[model samples]
Target: MLEIELLGVKMKNPTMLAAGVMGSTAASLNWVSCSGAGAVVTKSFSKMPNKGYKNPTTVEVTGGIINAIGLSSPGVETFKKELESINEEVPKIASIYGASPEEFSQVAGEIEQIVDLIELNISCPHAMSGCGAAIGQDPQLTFDVVEAVKKSVSVPILVKLTPNVTDLPEIALNAQKAGCDGLTLINSLGPGMKIDLETGRPILSNRFGGMSGPAIKPIAIRCVFETYAVADVPLIGVGGISNYHDVVEFLYAGASAVQIGTAIMNHGPEIFAQICQGLEKFMEEHGFQSVNEMVGLAHQF
Candidate 1:
């Protein structure tokens, strides 16, 4: 009853594991699949391995977490082995990033045959200079990267967008015009930061990282809400989703599927089954027969 299809990929349920959280290896991705997530997105990797930031990469705040994991990755060659091992029953999405359109397309073309979908990581708030939000925030760069990847790979290309932009609709439209198959809204809310009360210094080594969890759900939903109106492709919502109610909200906000990241840190992979169960009950009680029927319902008014 909860089945959903995004960019021609079939998902048994609407829940997917957001990239960068237990997505670095086959074991962890498979574990999430076993735990009931409909699909799994690999941690964002690049052409070359990145050591990422030093210690204190992640810090906890009131409503969610601040992470500057720096998009640490093992590089595509090594990551492909892990991608190949993912269970076929679960849809595996490879999240990759690069500094230019050529680099992005190279990585996508290399791994497109191994994964069901390719998520371009142009929106990481904490990525190093010349990458991450720097590319996504610019319409021309965003268009170039999406167009290049689309040209290189036959598989679906999903451009993950940064919420830090002033006008998300413009960016969304650009991506759609560039031939992207889908969109993933709101990577993280900030170059947000925290402080050490005792040390009187910044908490994370990177000084600033993306803010996630419940604190960002409202904005994530708003991005999905607004982008859905402008984007020609399907939307995948990611932000502060923590419960079944949050999942329902994303669907109402126009997301074809919802991804869980920070919530996994607090709730564990088991959260998938719990959310699916709760969502099923809620749907039964609400008299909704399919997840697609509930999508974008909130925009009706």
Candidate 2:
């Protein structure tokens, strides 16, 4: 009952593995697939290798954990091998990042034929200085990146946006105008930090990082709702989703699908099957025959 189609790619359910969780390798992606995720997105990679932040890159906080993984990637050439190894039955999305539109286009062109979709990582709050939320926060750069990727690849392009922006709808609209096939709302919420009281030092090596987990769900839902009001393309919601109810909330908020990230850290891959089974039951109880029927239902009022 929860099958969905987005950016022309078919999903058996509206659940996908969000980038930067357990998405770095073929084995993990396949594991998520076997566990019942309809699709899996790779950890964000770049055209060139990035060493990322040093030790203590992640820290636990009250709501969720903070991470400044610095968009660490092995680069596209090496990442291609990992992509080719994923099971064909499960659609694979390669999440890639670059500093400029040309660089983004070049990377997208390289992997277009190998993956079902390409997620432009314009929203990583802890990414390197020139990349990440900095570029996505600007509508013009968001437009340029989307336009460049659209020009470079035949595969569907999804622009992941940051919620840290003052005007998210404006950026979403710009992406649509530039021809993005879909949108992924609210990549980790803050460049937030935790400090050690005794040492008077920041907990993370990078000093600050993006927050994820259940704490960000409300903001994610709001971003999805607001973007749905203005965007012409489908929306993929990712943030603090932990169960079937969270999935239903995202769908009700207008997400065509929802991506699971930090939750996997606590629940393991088994969470995928658990959530899918629960979602199927919920759909039956709610009298929804398909996921499409549930999309944007809350907005009807």
Candidate 3:
């Protein structure tokens, strides 16, 4: 009941291990796949290695954690080692970021052999200059990046978008026009921040970072819902998914698949099976035969 095809890649289920969490190593990615996740996405990597931010890149917030990890990566060449190590039984996705179209295309080409799909990380709120949300915030820039990467790679491309935008549907339309195969809706929300009481200073080194967890799920759902109305490609929903019920909401919001990150941090890899099992029961009791049947069900009402 959970089987679904994404951009020609078949997955055992609709649940994926969201990038940036336990995605840095082949062992972790392999472990996640073994733990019941249908697929796994690596942490976003760049053409060249990046040290990212130093000490205290993450801090706990009310509904989630604010993170400014800066997309730390060992570069594509080095990341290939980890990619080669992933179990071939499960589909793998490589999340990549760059400052320009040339750079984005280069990285996508280099990693194309190692992953099933490439996800452009254009929506990181606290990325360094010239990268991340800066590119995604501009529709033209988003089109350029996606177009360049598409020209350079035969592999499917999924552009991860930012919720920190005025009109997300417009941006989604641009990506689809650029020939992108799929869309991953709503990267972390806000350059949200927190101040340390005793120190009288901002907690994160970057001062502000993306807000994630339960607080951003609503925004994610809205993004998926609106984009699905105009999008020609399948959508992947991500944000604050914590349980089977949350997964149901995302599917109802028009997500073909959903990625889990913070929930894994809060629980463990086992969350995949737990949610999948619960989802099976929900589907059976609801008289749904396939997960695809549940996609965008909310639109009926």
Candidate 4:
């Protein structure tokens, strides 16, 4: 009942392992697959190597944690080896980032044949200055990056968007116009920070980073609810998902599927199997026949 197919890629369930969680290597990606994620998105990699932020890259906050991992990637060339090593039957999505359209295309093209899909990481709040949210927050740049990647690879493209935007629909529509196959909404919430009272210094080495956890679920639901109304393509709901109820909320809010990130830090890869069990029970109790029945139900009322 939890099975889903997004943009021609089939998944056994709606829960995807969100990028930047335990997605950096073939070992971890395969681990999530074996653990039961419908699909796994690799940590965002760039065309060039990036060491990312220094020590203290993550700090716990009240509702969630703030992270400034800075999209540290070993670059596409090296990342290709990890992609090739993945042996799971479940779909694999490569999350890639770049400073410009050409760079985005270069990375996408390099990994196109290895992964099932490409998720454009134009939405990382803590990414390097010129990349990440910089491309996603603007309508034209989002278009340019998606368009460039679409031209470079035959694999479907899913553009991950930032909730930090002033108008989410504007960027969502722009990505659709650029021919992206689908969208991943709300990549974390804030470039939020925590300060140390003892030293009067910021906790994270990068000073601030995007926020993710239970606190951002409402905004993520809002983004999915709002974008589903205007977007023609499928929506992949992410951010702050911890349980099957949260998955139901995103599906009700109009997401065809959902991705889990920070929750994994506390729950471990076992969270995937746990959520699938909970989701299956929830579906049976609610009288839903399939995951598709729950999509966009909020818009009906």
* lDDT agreement with native, every candidate: 0.91, 0.91, 0.93, 0.92
Candidate 4's error at 163, in angstroms? Answer: 0.6
* Model 3 TM-score relative to the real fold: 0.99
List model 2 lDDT by residue over 162-215, tens digit each.
999999999999999999999998799988999999999999999989999999
Give lDDT tens digits, candidate 4, residues 1-301.
7888888889999999999999999999999999999999999999889999898999999888999998888988999999998875979999999999999998988889888999999988887776555888899999998998898899999999999989999999999999999999989888899999999999999999999999999999999999999999999999899999999999999999899999999999999999999999999998999999999998988
Q: Write the per-residue lDDT of candidate 1 for residues 1-301, one digit (tens) a residue.
A: 9888877788889999999999999999999999999999999999888888898999999899899988888999999999999999999999999999999999998898899999998999888775555888999999999998888789988899999999899999999999999899889888999999999999999999999999999999999999988777889999998889999999999999999999998889999999999999999999999998888999888
User: How does candidate 2 score on lDDT?
Assistant: 0.91
Candidate 3 global lDDT: 0.93
Which parts of model 3 have CA positions greater than 4 angstroms off?
Answer: none
Q: How badly does each model clash, as a count of residue pairs?
A: 1, 0, 0, 0
Model 1 lowest lDDT segment of ten? 125-134
What stretches of model 4 exceed 4 Å from their correct place? none
Each prediction's TM-score against the native? 0.98, 0.98, 0.99, 0.98
